[model samples]
Target: MAAPSSPPARPVRSRTSGPWAKLSTVALWMPFPALLWVGGYAGAEPRLFGLPFFYWYQFLWIFLSSGLTWCAYLHTTPTRPVRTGAHRPADPGEGLR
Candidate 1:
């Protein structure tokens, strides 16, 4: 009888912890609360191009939020290790042994 095959190796998961990690987490999450609270921008004293504060403020954030999200993505992502020829496996068949 043939031996049963083992399960494939799972990919390693990285856990980030540090000041930057916290900052990134906040950057990615802050937009929801800032936009959700209607009272914050419910005003008219400030106007841009004749638009009220509420309308213009939200539009401004639409662009700002995108920038913040990108900043958070950069902070949170891990740098991948470069693979050189010496580190690579010699052949696909080698793993089966």
Candidate 2:
């Protein structure tokens, strides 16, 4: 009987290691307060383009949250070295499965 070989070990990265990484994690939580606590800021005092403040505020967050997510992605993503043609996957369909 042949023994099973273990997969390659990946380097461990701390979630709060660097400032950028910590900011990236914090960016993800930006939307929770505004969206989750509806009654906290739900009011019809101010208006925008015939829309109520409550409505427009949430609608504006759609774009703002998207921008924040993009910023987090840019900050957290690591730059990898370009691979040469010499290095190839062990199996042609390795990732397909």
lDDT of 1 by residue, 1-97 (tens): 3444545544543436688789988888888988899898899968998999999989988998999988877777765544333333468786577
TM-score of 1: 0.63
List the candidate 2 regions with Cα displacement exceeding 4 Å: 1-16, 82-97
- The lDDT per prediction is 0.77, 0.77
Lowest summed-lDDT stretch of 10 residues in model 1? 80-89
For each of the candidates, give the backbone clash count.
0, 0
Cα displacement (angstroms), candidate 1, residue 73, comes to 0.6
Candidate 1 lDDT score relative to the true structure: 0.77
lDDT of 2 by residue, 15-90 (tens): 4458998888788898998789999659886889988889998999999899999998877776544433444457
